[model samples]
Target: MTDRPDPFAAPFGSLFGDSMTQAELVDGTYSYSGSAQPMENFSLHPATHVLHYGSACFEGLKAHRQSNGTLALFRLDDHVERMRQSIGLLRMPVPDAALIRSLIIDAVEANADFTPDPPGSLYVRPTFIGTAPNIGAAAVPSDMGLLYVICSPVGDYFAGGIRPLTIYVETKVPRTTPQFGMVKSGANYVMALGPTLDAKRDHGADQVLFATADDITETGASNFFLIDDDRIITRQLDESFLHGVTRDSVITIAGDLGYSVEERPLSPSELADWAETGEVFLSGTAAVVAPVGTVIVEDSARTVRDGEPGPNTLRVRDALTTLLTGDADDPHGWRTTVSG
Candidate 1:
C-alpha cells in the first residue's frame, strides 16, 4: 500500500489496482488470454455502438481481507449471473459465467496486495461494452464487444462511515424506465441523475427515493427497507426495480435470525406511517445496510423514529459484516476464496 493515497482519504472507487483482465467478443465468439495484465485504457472508435446506442452494463462486488489474512469474494456466483443477465438485456454477446468468474478471481488475486483492512476492501467492477463502430445501428445489437474486470481499494461508499442518511422522496419522478429498471445498465443510472441532483441541491438530501404513482420502488442505487421488532418488509420483485443481492442477503439473514420477511408493494404514505413507529433502511452492494434518518416528502421533512440508527438495522448490518470478513461461519456458502 506504499506510494499510494489512503483509500479512506480519497473518494470511493477513485483508486484502482495494478492489473486487469479483458476478453474481446468478435462476431459471436469470445477470446481471452486467461490471465490478468497491466491496467491500461482502451482505444475506442468515435462511432462505437456503446457510445451512441447505450449498449453497456456493469456489476459491482467486493473482495474482503478476512481476519485470517486471506481475501474472499462475497456472493461471487450471484454477481456473475446478474452481470450475464445485464449483458443479455443489452443485446450484446454475453460471455459464459465461468469466464466472468475466472476473470474476476484472477483480477482479485493479482491485486490481493492492495486489499485494505476490515473497514476497507477491494471493490471489483466487471464492465461490458459494445465495440462495433456503427452509429447507424440504433435498432440493432452490436456483434463486437469488450468485457473486462478491474479492482479498486475502497474505504466506504458513503462519505461518512456507518451513519444515518437523509433521503428525499420523489413521487412524480421514477428512478428509471419501468421496463428496463431491472437491468444493471448505465442508461438506467443516467435517467435518475436529474432527480437525485435536484434532491441533493434543493432539499439537502443524500439520495432520492423514487416512488412513481405512489408506489415505492427504490433509491437511485439501492433498495428500500422497513424494519421493526418482529418483521422485515421490502418491495416485491418486479421489472420496475432492481433485485439487489444485498437485499436478498438481508432478508434471508433476518428470517434466519427470527424476523418475519414480507415482500410486497410499499408506498410513501405507508412509509411515513412506519417512520413514526418502525425503522427504515437501504441496502445494496455499495451500501451494505444504511439507516434512514430523515425523509423529505413533498417538501415536508419527516424524521424516522428518533432519527438515528436503530437496533435491528445495526444487528443485521453487523451480521452481514461478520460474514463478509470471515469472522462468522459460512452456512450459506456465499464466499469465494481467491488464491494466487
Candidate 2:
C-alpha cells in the first residue's frame, strides 16, 4: 500500500492497490496479457463513445482477508455475471464469463497484500467503457471497448460504521429510469446523485429511498428491506432495481437463521407502519447489510425500532460477514479463495 492514512480513516475506495488487470475488445474479439499489470491510466480519444454517449458500466465486489489469513472473494461468479449483464445492456460485447472471472482473480492476486483486516477488505471494481471514438454514434453502441479491473483497500462503505442510517423517502423522483435499474451502469448512479445530494442537504439523511408514486423500490445505492424477529420483506425482483448479490446472500442467511423471507412489492404506507414495528435495513455489494434508523416520509421522520441497530439486523450482518471471512462454513459455495 502507498503511504497514506489508513483506509479505515479515509473515505471508502480512496486507496487503490498497486496492480490491476485489463483487457480490450475490438472487432468483437477480446484480448488480454493474461495477468495483472501495474495500475495505470488510459489514453482515450476526445470523442470516445463512452465519454459522449455514456456506453459504460461497472461492478463492485470485494476480496476479504479471511480468518485463516488467506484472501477470498465473496460471490465472485455472481458479480462476474452481473458485470456481463451490465456490459450487454450497454450494447458492448460481453466478455466470456471465464475471462471476466480471470481478470478479477488476477487483480486480487496481484494486490493481495493490500487486503485489510476484518471489517476491511480490498474493494474490487470491474469497469467497461466503449472506446470507439465516434461522437456521431450517439444513438449507436460502440464497436470497440475496454474492460479493466481495479482494487481498492476499503473499510466501512457508509461513513458511520454499522450505525443505523437515516434514510430520506423520496416518493417523487425515481432512482433511475425504470427499465435500466438492474444494470450496473454509471449513468444510473449519476441520475440518482442529484436526489441523494438534495436529501443529504435538506434532511440530513444518509440515503434516499426512491418510493415513486408511493411504490417502494430501493435506495440510491442499496436494496431496502423491512425485517423483524419473524420475517424479512423486500421488493421482489423486477426491472425496477438492482438485484444485489448481498441481497440474495442476506435472504439465504435469513432463511438459514429461521426467518421467513418475503419478496414482494412494498409501499410507502406499509413502510410508515413497518417503521414502528420492524427494523429497516439496506443491502448491496458495498453496503453489505446496513440498518436504517429513520425514514423521512413526507418530510416527517419515522424512527425504526427505537432508532438503533436492531439485534436481527446485526445478526444478519454478522452472518454475512462470517461467510465472507470464512469464520463460518461456506454452505452456499459463495467464497472463491484467491491464491497468491
Candidate 3:
C-alpha cells in the first residue's frame, strides 16, 4: 500500500496524488493518452499564453470511498459539463465531455489508494491552460491549449471540520467582472483575492461574502444560502456568479426535505434580517454544506441565530453527506461508480 498522510492533518488541496492524466490541444484537436502518467512539472516557455494572457480554468470535484467499499465520484457529469463551459468561455476549443470524463476517471483510478475515509475523499481537479507561447496575443485567445486532471487527498475545507464559518460581508467590492462571473478561471479568483485577504486581515474572518452594492451573489469560493424552518433562500442564477453544482444539489435536497426553495436576488440588508431568525451557510464541492455562525456587515459582527450551527444546517449537511458516502439511496443518480 502507498503510504499516505492523515488527510485531516493536511490543508485542503495541499497534498496531491503521485500521478496525473493530461492532454494537449493543437490546431483545434486534443491528444490524450488513455491512462494516467507520473505527475511531473511541465517545461513551459516563459512566454506561454497562459502565463501572460491568462487563458486557464479548472474544476474541483471529489471521489468518495463509499460505505460498500467501492469508490464513487459525486456529480461527475455535472462537473465535466461545467468545465467544458469554462474552457469555452476562454475561447479555447473545448474538449468533448466524454474525453474530460475519461481523463478524470482515469486519474482517479490510478490514484485510488489516496482516497481517504468519509469526511475525507480524493479531490479531483481538472485544469486547462492555453499553451501557445505568445504574450503578444494579449487580446487574442490562444488556439493551442493543454488540459489535465490531478487528484489530491483532502479533508475539511474549513478548519475545525463541520463547524460554522464567520463571513465578512463586502457590500461595495464585487468579486469579479460581471461577464466573467460564471467562469472558473484563475483570473476570476485573483480578482477576488485582494478583497478576501483584506477581509481576513481586517476582520479575522474565514471568508468574504461579495454583496456588490447590497446585491448578494456569492462568496469568494462558495455559494451562500439562508435557511429557516420553512424556506431555503439563495441568490438566483444569473451571470453574476458561479452556478455551483453543490448549490443545485442542496436546492434539490431541500425540495425533497419539503422546504420552500426560493431563488431570487438577495441583498445585504435582507441577509441581515434573515439571519435574525434563520441560519446561513455556504455550499460548494470543497465546502460541502458548511454553516454560517456569524456574518460581519458594515463592520458589525452579527451572530447567526445564537452563534452556533443550527439544526436545519446540520440536517441539510447530513443529507448531502449520506448521499456522498453511499449510506443513503441516491435518488438523483448523482454518484458515478469507478472501477479499481
Candidate 4:
C-alpha cells in the first residue's frame, strides 16, 4: 500500500484520512453499515434540502494519544449529547445517543494509526444533513438523512506556539439567534462569518467577540473567559451562545486549583474594568485556552493584564493538558480509551 500523506501539514479540511464511517436514515429509522472507504467527493442532488434549506449540523472533538500508547477521547459523551440536541432542534432524524457514540469511536479507532501525539491530535467531525431534493417546501421533516464521521490529524492551530490574540468586541451584530445559539448547527457559524470577516479586515483582529444587545456572548467559535489573580469569571450559560465542553473542563480544573469561579453576564463596558485587574482567555475544543492580549472596542483598545498569557491562564492550560495526556489523575473521568 502506498503511504498516506501527512494530514497535519495539509490545510484544514483538504486532507482527510483513508476511511470514514457512514450511516443513513430512511422512513424515520437509521441503518448504519459501512466501512472506512477512501476519502472522495460526495454525491448529492442539486436541490438537496441541506443545500436549499440549510438542514445540517456538526460536532468537533479530538482524540489524544496518551504517553502510554493508548488513545483516549476527551469528553466524547458530552459531544455526542450535544449533537443529539442539535439534531432534535433541527428536526432531523438521527440515531440514538449510544449509536452516535459508537460511530464516533469506531471511526476514530479505524484511523488510529493517524492519531498524532502530544500537541497534535486526530480531529473528529460528525456531520448530519438532509438529503431529500425537495426544495420548494422544506417545512415537512426530511425523510432522508446522512450521518458520517471524518478524521484528520491536525497540528497546533497557531504554528508559532501559544501567544496572546487580538479580538474585536462587536456590539451591533449578534453572533446568532438566541434559540439556535446553543445548538452546534452550521447556520450559527454561518451567521457570524460575514461580521467576523469584516472584523478581521477592518480592525486586524483574529476573532470577533460577539455581544448581545446588552451582554457579551462569545468569540467566533469559542467561549470567552476572564482570569484574575484569584477568580475566573465568564458569561453564565443561557440561550445566547454554545456551552462548550472545553469551557466546562477549564472551569472544573480551575476550581480544583483553589480559584473562585463565577458565571455571569459580561458587558462591553466592563472590558476596561476587567482588563485593569485581570487576564482574559478564549476556551474551546480547537483553542483549548487561548489567551487574549488585546480587546478592541470600536476604535479604542484595551490591553489585558501585562499584555501576555497570564500565569493563571498558563497554569490552567497545563493542568488540563496533563489530565488529557494521562500524566495527572483524571478525577472527572472525561477521557475514553479507544481500542486499536
The predictions' CA RMSDs to the true structure, in order, are 0.8, 1.0, 0.9, 1.7
Misplaced by over 4 Å in model 1 are: none
Model 4 quality (TM-score): 0.96
Candidate 1 residues 63-176, lDDT tens each? 999888888999999999999998988877778999999889999999999898978999999999899999889999988999999999999899999888999999998888
Residue 187 CA displacement from its true place in model 1, Å = 0.6
53-155 in candidate 4: lDDT tens per residue? 8889999999998988899999999999999988998887657998788889889988888877778788899999988888875687677898889988876
* lDDT, ranked from best to worst: 3, 1, 2, 4
Poorly placed runs, candidate 2 (over 4 Å): 1-4
lDDT of each: 0.93, 0.91, 0.93, 0.85
Model 1 residue 222 CA deviation in Å: 0.6
Q: How far is candidate 3 from the true structure (C-alpha RMSD, Å)?
A: 0.9
Prediction 4 global C-alpha lDDT: 0.85
Please give, for residues 75-181, the per-residue lDDT of candidate 3 as tens digits.
99999999999999998898999999999999999999899898899999999999988979999989788899999999998978888788999988899999999
